[model samples]
Target: MERSYPRDPEWEAMPDVGLEVWPHSPPDTAAYGEARAQALQAPEVEKPFSENLANEALDIPRSQERALSYRVSALMASLARLNHCDDEPTQADMRLIQEQRMLVAMQLAGSPSLQQRLTNPAWVADCWSDALASLGAIGVRVENLPEDCPWDQDALLDGPQPNGRNR
Candidate 1:
């Protein structure tokens, strides 16, 4: 059966981006959402109390061990999948991803959280900002950057991306 998105009729939106004190409107006007969800569950059977307690009680360490086991198992499964794959990312693809990381890092570095650390030479070098700068050079202009991007996000305002975003 095709799944349908259940409706919420009263989700009114606000025009501005600032913080909100309270929900302007509640979404569930009729309160039928919970009713619909509960109707989908099977009715409880007349099972024994011991059987019910056994199912309800969990071995916490065993549960945690199972989670950790699955996590490592997933990592192993991913490694196997990568091993079986015929095509792998090329140098150019890796370079493109690295460029995007640099762009995103540049965005992150200029955020208010990093304001105090931005101008520090150590912060710049730690992110390999200069090495990436001299490597590829994407030439986007200052005004054309992302809306929230800093004026001089990385390197200089005048220089190109490592490959030449400026030129």
Candidate 2:
């Protein structure tokens, strides 16, 4: 179940100086790509009622809450299964572990300490523009960029997610 981003030449050329691991392409681009294409083809009037209803059924707050709930359920199940473990995890188990780790990282990104570190004047002064430019080059919307320093919790947690991709 391991997943990877589509390869990009620009990403290859960028030096890996360990500031941030730039994704090869937008996260979950491949997984939801077909859905996006289908959405584009179907006119608003022709689209299914359930599809239109779903859009308004869950707002940002609800979506985040649901994601966290699912993540917790998966983690609890994993821990329960691992309690009696005596051998190496299978590939499936490894995938679950990776997924949970990515979710945790995304959650941590919103923590005050991590947010402070990201906005530290010293590091941000050196890397903010380059980071934003690199993301833009990969077709990630520049609107994802924060408006100012010390970004609020909503903004910090509102950007793209790894969506369980191992990378």
Candidate 3:
């Protein structure tokens, strides 16, 4: 008796192969080389500092600016809620605050002017003072702040001075 093996019906139904032919001729090597050489010979134009700065500034669309403003408003709301609560802030609340701060920082960092402004300690302090004031104006009591809060407690309570300094 002969031994039998299982055969795949689908494979058996496939047509037998014949010689393969390319649909099109191979690319012309000389033309490719000439094009590549021309590309290599092209001069690289470097933009001036002012033009580059202007381009960078223009890269951020107005929609993105609106989004950043919206995010900042949301952060302020979160800060108000956290500050108003008498109970200690939960871990999630702290995380949200940190995340919002990081996002705002990242957005501000995108602008060269903002980046330069951030380097000024006084400007940063004033920004914090202004934020706290805004929260206070909205009836959000600026009390029970986290220990790691950036603004000075006394300054925040007294309100910002004319010189943007906490009295």
Candidate topping lDDT: 3
- Give the per-residue lDDT digits (tens) of candidate 2, residues 57-159: 3343344444543553344334323332344556787566567756745744432233343335554433444444554665655463443322332432343
Q: What lDDT score belongs to each candidate, Candidate 1 first?
A: 0.34, 0.44, 0.49
Q: Of the candidates shown, which would achieve the greatest TM-score relative to the real structure?
A: 3
Candidate 2 runs further than 4 Å off: 1-58, 85-88, 107-167
| Model 2 poorest 10 in a row by lDDT | 158-167
Residue range with the least summed lDDT across 10 consecutive positions in model 3: 158-167
- The parts of candidate 1 lying over 4 Å away from their true place are 4-98, 129-158, 161-167
Model 3, which residues run further than 4 Å from truth?
1-61, 114-167
lDDT of 1 by residue, 80-152 (tens): 2222234464556445445544544443333323333446555433333333332224332223222221223
Range of the 10 consecutive residues with the lowest summed lDDT in candidate 1: 140-149
Tens digits of lDDT, candidate 3, 82-101: 65555566777777777776
Please report how far candidate 3 places residue 154 from its true position, in Å.
15
Instruction: Name the lDDT of candidate 1.
Output: 0.34
Error of model 3, residue 113, in angstroms: 3.3
Winner of 2 and 3 under lDDT: 3
Rate residue 149 of model 2 by lDDT.
29
